[model samples]
Target: MVIVCCSILIISCIAVVSSGMKVSLEVDRPWLRVHLSQRAALECCYRTGAASLRTTWFVHNQPANGTAVPVPVRASDQVSSGYRMRGGVTCGTLTFAEVKVADSGLYRCWFNDAGVFTPGTYLQVYEPLKKTINLSEKTKDNILMAEGFLLLLCVLVPSATLLCKSKQLHALEQKKATREEENIYQGLDLNDCDKAMSLYQDLVANEQEEIQLENP
Candidate 1:
């Protein structure tokens, strides 16, 4: 009877082991960093199985083997470990109360019953970037401004050239007209007898009219 009871117990244990569920870790955020008004928090959740699941936290700081720290599915006062349960999912959070430069590394949450792991989350702790200029965007703006100026120049240059050419043509026409008038005056011949006689008669008539006005 003792042998039969032992067999039954063994069979029950086996059945329980076989009924254990496979689990997967769910990460809330993959990237963590130190920022103003924001604390560093890493959360991973997994569904509960028929049996209590074993969870482990691994931190890969160096190229060698990582440090494995077992995590209980219970809350702790320690700054490195914490747990919470919601909607049938158990979530484990690792909090860095005081983020350090050395905290920048890869972290992983592993589930043993489900034989699955959460992808590594890279945590970065550093000084926040200050307000500064974006040179790339500024450069693009400057290039566009320069292109606009060049386009304006391209339009104005041809217009100025055409204006100058018109002025030159107008000046040439004026000079040609003056030259033609001078040539016509030079071509007149006062030595012609009829022209000389006509000029003498006009002079005599002008002198007689001035004398008559003076006497009257």
Candidate 2:
């Protein structure tokens, strides 16, 4: 009869422990963005009525249908993984020595105590801070591009102007040379007076011969 009475008491205690209880989950930060090779701490705080609890950490991905995959947290020379328990509360800290690109995802903390499980706190981990060109960098790039264009214009415009001026100068020199050659030819003709008189005598002789042939 004593054994039966003890079993009944145990059953009643189990029933009371398994009853609905209020619990809440809290995180230190709502979102986090970290760089590669940097350490990240995902702090989780759970408030529950249970005196003792067992907590599990998981990484959930949407492609996996929000399934909670358990993360192996062991105290190692590289990474330290552990949890702390206080009066009616627990905090689990997962630390990484060096973060990688594959480590970016959503994390959650699950707890179970006395058959009651509380919803977890989600911790987001990022792979690394992306190298982004901010407004100033973009503006600097634009300025550099504009400067390059202006420099090219400065070089090309002067080269084009010099080329045009050289063409114009060459034309003027050619015209001047032609005019000087014509003046030299005129001076030579004016100096050859004997040759002009001989040509006029030959023309008069041919005209007299034509006139005598016509009269005969």
Q: Which ten residues in a row have the lowest lDDT in candidate 2?
A: 114-123
Question: Which stretches of candidate 2 lie above 4 Å from their native place?
Answer: 1-22, 27-30, 49-52, 61-75, 83-90, 114-156, 162-216
| Candidate 1, 2-29: lDDT as tens digits | 4543453355345434756644345346
Error of 1 at 129 (Å): 4.6
Clashing pairs in 1: 22-114, 23-114
Q: TM-score of every model?
A: 0.44, 0.42
How accurate locally is residue 195 in candidate 1, as Cα lDDT from 0 to 100?
83
What TM-score would you give candidate 1 relative to the actual structure? 0.44
**In model 2, which residue pairs have backbone atoms overlapping below 3 Å?**
none
The candidate that achieves the highest lDDT relative to the unseen native structure: 1
